[model samples]
Each structure stands twice: as C-alpha cells, then as structure tokens.
Target: MLRDRDNVFCFTANNLDNSLSRLTFNSCTASSIPSSTLQTPPPITYTQPGLYNVYFVSDEGLPTMQVDCKQIRVLPQPIIEINNDTLICQRDTILLVANGPNLYSALWSPVHNTIPPFDTTSIRVHPQEDYRYNVHLEFTQGGGCAYDTSVLIRVSKVFADAGPDRFVADGAYTILGGPRMSMGQEYSYVWTPPTYLSSIVKPNPTSRPLDVMAYYVTVTNDSTGCFHSDSVWVRTECTEIHLPNAFNPVSDVAVNRNFGLLNNNVVKLEYFKIFNRWGQVVFETTDTGKKWDGTQNNIELPPDNYVWIIDGYCVNGKRIKKQGTVLLTR
Candidate 1:
C-alpha cells in the first residue's frame, strides 16, 4: 500500500525493487518526508561542469524516511594550456598542453597576426615580436570548446649598423675636407677618389688632390677602420745661381780690364786666390781684377788649368762662397 502524507508518498512493498524511479521537485520549494525511503537522493548528475542544487523527496505519507538535498557539478569543455607567458633571448620556446579530455582540434591566434609555426596541442613556439597569443581547444564530444591561456611576448630589436669616420692632412695642418665624417657604428665604407683626384687608393686613399691644382693628399684609417687624411702642396719658389766664366785683371793705361765685384760695385775686393791641379794656392792678389800674368815669382808660368774660390755677399744680406775651375789663357 502507498499513502500520501502531503506532497510526499509512502510505500510499503513486500518485495525489493531494482528499477530506478525518476524524481521531480520544485527547485525553490521545500517538502518534508520520512527519512526511511529517501535517506539521500542517489548522487545527482549535472548538465554542465558547474555547481547545481538537487532536491530529494519521498512518498507524501512515508513518515519512516527522511530526505536531504545537496549539490553536484559536471566538468566543462577541454582547454589548451601554455606553461609560460613570455620568452627570452636564450630560452624562446613555449610549451603547451591540453586541459581537457577528447580534444579534437587546437588553434592559436596572435593579436598582431604574427603567425607562429606551431599551432597545435603541445606546441613549441618562438615568437619574434611583442604580441598577445591565445589558445583555443575544441573537444570531439558534442562541440565542447575551451581556452587555456593568453600570453604577451616581447622580442628584442636588433640595431642597425653605421659607417666610419673622415680624414685630414699634415698632422699639424687643418683638413679642408676630402671625405666627410661618418658615425662610429658597425658598417663598411668604400670611398673612391674625389672627382678632383686621380689616385688609386680608396676610402683611405693616398696622394689625392682636393682640386685640379698640384695638391697631394693621402687618406687612411686606424687599426679599427677609422679614416684620416693628410694633404700638402709645393710652397717654395724657384731659384737659380748665375756664374761668370772668367774675369780680367790687367791694370792698363787705356783699358783697366777688371771683373770688378759681384754685380758691379756693391762689393769691394777682399781677397783673390787661385789653386793648381794639386789644390795648392798658386796665385793671390788684393788688387781687384789683377791678372796672374802667367807668372810664379817673376818666372813665366805655364798655361795649365787652375781652380778659383770666390767669396762675396748677396743683396739679401746673405754671404756666398763660390768655387770653380778657371783657365789662364796667357
């Protein structure tokens, strides 16, 4: 017999039953029943992986059993999980794993659209830029889906290389500029001669001219590839030395032929000397332009070659010493 106490039912059957009976209850309503028939509702199942409250009730007249209510949970979908949120210069690989069972597909997305080579579960990824990455896992069971993590990656920027420096001439002189100066960085420089120059040496060229003039300059570099140059031009004037072949020294009544002095009369005769082939002083005189008369101590001398040494002053306040060979025709 089964009796209804209020909303609960009571049943006293003589045989044990194995069939499961489905129970219905108002989620917000509460009812009292004997604890004998409903000691506790068999563990309840949930539709999703979250907490849910379950109500238990017995036959309305069953006063011998008491019922209790509790909560249950059903696990959600699968999710892809990553171990780290960042990578460094040395260690750049990212490890990934699935957080749920029955995962059929996995996908990853970068906010910046920087595609990574590895996009599946248990992926090893190395990102080259700063961005956000997300992992999406799709389960094989009934369209279940999950996301484990989103991470930000920072990639170091490689710096650009710069070239070398310039040159100047005569270590003491200033440089007008053959080649312009360059920044001190990491780069190679190849310089040809300037349009004005016709030299072979490149960036560190030697003997290059700044203009079409007779200027010469050399360009070079330091041990570490730094550039420098030196330039120079012929700065001295041309000079010449004029000499006479012979001088007359016969004191004549009509023609007192005399070599005179250096350029006419600016210098006075100091001393005159003559040397033989053996470098001996053979003849000397203080009378300006006095000829040897081809004589040695009143004896007629032979016509042999002799050397002459002349000492005089220049117009520029400089003294000059000249030595040469002269022949006595007499």
Candidate 2:
C-alpha cells in the first residue's frame, strides 16, 4: 500500500566483457550504482514516494544496448458507520454505539463519559439544541492515518400552549388550544379528557361543558416521536342572573322592551343598579320582579350605553356578584 511503501528493486544484466554494466535508480533522491559482469546489484530500498525509474545498461561485443527508465507509482490512504443522522426532541437521551474490527481508539466529539479499550464503544447523549457529532476511529493498522465518520443529532424544540383560561356561559361552546412548536412530518395534536369537545386531534377544538373543566393538549412530532404538553381551564358561569346586553323600549317585542333578567331566580336581591358613561345613576332597584322600563323620575331616558351591576343570591343559595354593559335603544 502507498501508506507504507517499501520495495526492493534489483536489475538483471548480461555483460560478458564487464566493460559496460551499470544500474541507475532514479527517484527524488536519485542514486546510481553498478555491478560488473552480469552480477546483480544489492537490492535498492525505496523510502519516499512518487514515480521511480530503474535504468539499466548492458554491453555486448557487437553493440552497446541501454534500457530506458521503468516507472513505479505510489498513492495517501482514505464508514465504520455507527448510525445514520437522527433527530430527537429536547431533553431526551439516546445511545450512540459503534462496533468495528481491529479498532485502536474511538472518540466522539461534544464529549461524553466513556470507558477505555474502545473496540466497541457506546455512549449516551442528551443535547438541548441541534448538534453534529463527529466520530474518529483509529484502527491498529492505520499507521498514523486517521479514519473518520459523523452523525448529525438534530434537536427539535417542542412546545405546547393550551390557551389562556376560558370563561364560558353554561352550555355555551368555546374553542380550546393555543400555540405549539413541533418538528417532522404528519404532526398531530391531542386534547386530553376529550369530553364535550368537537375534535381531539385539532389544534383548536370546540367544547360545550356543563361545569368547570380542565383540558390538556399535547403536540407530537411524528418524525422524532417526541411530544410536549400544556393545560388550560374552562370555567362555567352556569347558574346566575342572565341580563340582556341590549333593549328597545319602543319595540313591540315584549322581551326586548325592558332590561333585566327574564326570570329572576334570586332568593335575596341585595341591590341592582345601572349607571351612564359619566357614572351617573340612571336606574336603581331592589325588587327582583320590578325591572327597568327605560325611565328616570317618570320621564323617558335617551338611548345609550349603561353599566349594570348585581349583587344577590341565586335560588340555589349561591352568592353572585358581577357587572356588565348594556345598550339602551329607543
């Protein structure tokens, strides 16, 4: 092999008179020696590299014959494939193992804890970001030549946000789930406790719950087989006073004529008040059955937005206090 090129070069010669017998070893460090009377010269040892020439001359009694230069060429030495390039989720660990024949030493970059005598070496790696691991294997016959291989360990940063806490009226539908970060093809989503939800695999699924519920969502990377999770809550204002957001005092529809709960279930009405934009008290009452008729001091008030407040106890004996705005249309 070119790595350790050592050869013995000798010449065969025929010269009876021994008048002309010679050998010329042509190389980078050119040298020439000759033997007389058809005797072969001592073997020439080649130390360096590249093309070499062996020139020989023979002389007969008739005519002298000389041979041209003969050439020899020499060329540097050039996968202990442990594993192919791989991808994984963050915070996860994987094993990198390699087994090869006649190994003297094996080392991996981005260092890890390893034992000696690395003929067959295996190590565990956990990386946070994308990284490329380079492996160097030195064989016993390498003769100072280095053999190398590499495996790319790509880290996929995964995240899942199940949206902010939600507030929905009882029996009302609301969408769930928020943001997510993932990698690989055919990525999928999963929402836990799929009850009352329209879809479990969708990033944002509709839900209709009768009571408070907590939902969790997981985002999975199909290629890396990695996942991340987060949770959110859906609280229900299920049993309380229901106030109309808009009203028309001059409308023929009786339901749109006044502003108040359609049917009061309040066991104890603490207070009920409505204020204008300037925080002026326009309508105030404590009687649950007596609702506002869009009037103040027996005069019709102008149509505008008004803030309404309620502090009372439901028929189920649950205390409630809340405030909201309502439109007053003539």
Writing each residue's lDDT as its tens digit, candidate 2 over 126-236 gives 778777767777665535435677777888777777889988864357888764444335568889898889899888889877577899989887766778898999987
Model 2: lDDT to the true structure: 0.70
RMSD of each: 25.6, 12.0
Specify the highest-lDDT model's number: 2
* All candidates: TM-score: 0.27, 0.47
Candidate 1 per-residue lDDT, tens place, 143-245, comes to: 3544446666654322211122233221111222233433233323333334433233333333323222233333323323323333333221111112334
lDDT of 1 at 275: 79
Q: Which stretches of candidate 1 lie over 4 Å from their true place?
A: 1-73, 76-80, 90-100, 111-119, 122-128, 141-143, 158-330
* Residue 260, candidate 2: C-alpha displacement in angstroms: 9.2
- How many clashes (backbone N, Cα, C below 3 Å) per candidate? 23, 0
Candidate 1 all-Cα RMSD: 25.6
For this target, which candidate reaches the highest TM-score against the unseen true structure?
2
lDDT of each: 0.42, 0.70
Worst lDDT run of 10 residues, candidate 1, spans: 234-243
